[model samples]
Target: MIDTHAHLDFSQYDTDREQVIEECRRNGVQFIINIGVDFQTSKASVDLAEKYDFIYASVGYHPHDAKAMTDSIFEEIAQLATHPKVVAIGEIGLDYYRDMSPRDIQKAAFIRQLQLAERLKKPVVLHIRQAMEPAFEILRRHPGNYGVLHAFPGNAKEAAEGVRMGYLIAFGGPITYPNSQGPQVAASLSLSKIVTETDCPYLTPQQFRGKRNRPDYVRFVIDKLTELFPRYSRDDIVRITSKNAARLFNLPVDDSPELAYMIGKSLYLNLTSRCTNNCYFCPRNSGFHVAGHNLRLNQEPQEKDILTAVERYSGYNEIVFCGIGEPTLRADLMISLAAELKSKKLPIRLNTNGQGNLIAKADLPSKMRGLIDFVSISLNAQDETTYVKICRPQFGAKVFPEILKFAKDCKEYGIVTIFSVVDVPEIDIDACKKIADKMGIPLRIREYASD
Candidate 1:
């Protein structure tokens, strides 16, 4: 796990800073990006980074101290940012809730640091509070800068907008608070756009709230994330959030493609990255990541390759023929692989775009009678027009009816068939639910993860 934001330089940890950092190392905290709020703290952050190979620094002026910023101080920050261990420029932005600095001064300081980060080609760590509108407006005017909205203080729509503008929304201790909006906002955005941070020596997790926040306490944040994303495991949260921090900070970490991944005891196989529809809300357009695993495959896996990948694991509730792509595109391979896996007595589920029959020119569901126990078909729209508008299938206007027919065929073959819809703005959930009810099939509403 990576604690993206921390402040060990604070006097709160003066007596046991080394012990806290050592505990973080033993608790699997891979990296920590110590933040600087002023000239002295920036130098202390640099000192910490230089002392520990696993620690990195981000130099900038906090909005609370914007009034104290001068040209020379800004230049000092610019110089510190050039250090190899200094990965980003931040702990900067407007904080109207405090109003410690004049709003105008805060704005000017924010813009200057933003310009510095842009010229330096480094990502930023924003700390906007009640001044989200102005902060976001300033960010819009000064485009081409990307980073995280640290300790994000906005609604789900704002989070989506930040992601659309190439920024990540970070959630920390507040997420674990009762009735907090963090879980809802986290659920609404793509896993790829979410990162975990402690804002340590500040927002402590609920389990240890009121106590000083430590880097190792980041695990509590991950625990809350697991509840928000029930499909993902604790380890998935660790790897995914760590990867997000690494990518943003250019930290050294392994980010290879995953062929087979586990999510809540089910092993999902990525047979291909090829898809039948180019849905507007699909993550493929931005990044082929689903539940934190990179599904962007360089090559489609063969039958033996798939078998070998699964052989290294056991105790899965089921094997899912699902990835960012339509698994049925490789129909024969899926059927053969399912037949072989059936011998192990574990059930197999297939998640598809429901164009299997159209693609194969055959009743594909009938062939998978005993092999597939459950099948989820993407009934993404209530009608053909909506389907065409959202899915934009290569097979054109005739795809929707065929998908319904495919679902019907699967039910007739004794397979548990279900209809699924992504809850995007374009989709009519009530209409889709009516269609599923009329057909006596269950409809599963999937949250739209904005890219």
Candidate 2:
């Protein structure tokens, strides 16, 4: 996993830098982001990153060291950032713990570096302390996608603002300690809004307290994370946080086309791996990849977690109910959630099997009339026999009639209904379109994926 924030450039690593690197590699730590608190440290960080392939760096003046920042410092930082290994602009923000640098200087330096990060198109790793008000003000003033509040200690409202500004909240080793409120809150956030880091040489977990924290200790942080979020597997957290780190830092992540991707902003959910029907050409079973986004949700996330995900993405273009499982299975929850989102005027869409009515044993379209803006249903087969053969639905002969009737019902209810037929060899495309036309609804052809 990407460290995202660390202080290997500090004197703590002078004696065992090489050993640290080796241990990091052995413990499955992919990258260590060496951060700088001043010009000298920033330069040192860049030098270490240049020397070690697995090490990256961030260059900025920490609030505590803001006293040393000058106009010339910016030029030096700009020059150092040219290094490919330089990923971000901080470890920069207010730290009222010491207030070593005067408040004025700290604000000046922080704002300057914020502009620097924006100009460089790089993320900033923040070190906000008790100055949440001003720190948040500066962050909101410069809204960009590349930033994270490292070792985040803000309240839920502040965290919401950070996410709205497109920042990930990273939790470090302190999260593993018994009395650490910062990391505890961070761990409870949606997995999509969280990233894991060691913040090595500092903020060590309880077991490693007063000792130099290392990259291997990242697992301890993850342990605390699992204990807190509990919704995600340790592996899922690793993969997801690694991807988030890679995206924000512009590191090379696996760009395989097998993944599903969203163009702009949208709230996403990864519901389930299990499906009621085994459609021969459906990607739901093989692995539902959303372009570069993986939708193989390991477990059913709690409604609270789902709502958190929705809240984290409320600033998006829309919140879509396209998850690995049929959204209808969680119909009651989805409908209730849709009403909440409706209160916020958030657009909502449902990617379904077109059997919500059958599953709920009621009129779903009318039930969801004002709550859902769009309904996309899979109409993989035109007739009962083809439906049974292709979909292998649990409902057998009843599936085809139920789906067609549901699609028609959705259309009649004035909902934007889309009937989709997977492009499989055995499934007649023209027949599916004819069925859609007969129902007076729009038709779509979905790609037949392995699962």
Q: How many collisions per candidate?
A: 0, 11
Tens-digit lDDT string for candidate 1 (1-451):
9989999999999999999998899989999999999999999999999998899999999999999999999889999999999999998999999999999999999999999999999999999999989999999987879999999889999998788777988989999999899988998776778888999999999998999999888898899888887778788788888888898999999766778888778999899999999999988996887666789999988899999999988778899999889999999999999999998898899999999999999999989999999999999998999999999999999999999999999999999999999989888999999999989999999887665
Error of 1 at 17 (Å): 3.1
Candidate 2: residue 123 Cα off by (Å)? 0.9
- Per-residue lDDT value at 65 in model 2: 89
**Could you give candidate 2's per-residue lDDT for residues 37-146 as a string of tens digits?**
88899999998888888888998888998998878887898788777889999888998879999998899998888888888888888998888988888777777635
Task: Go through the candidates in order and give each one's C-alpha lDDT.
Answer: 0.91, 0.77
Best candidate, TM-score: 1
Give the worst 10-residue stretch by lDDT in candidate 1: 285-294
Show model 2 residue runs off by greater than 4 Å: 259-451
Q: By summed lDDT, which 10 consecutive residues of candidate 2 come out lowest?
A: 255-264
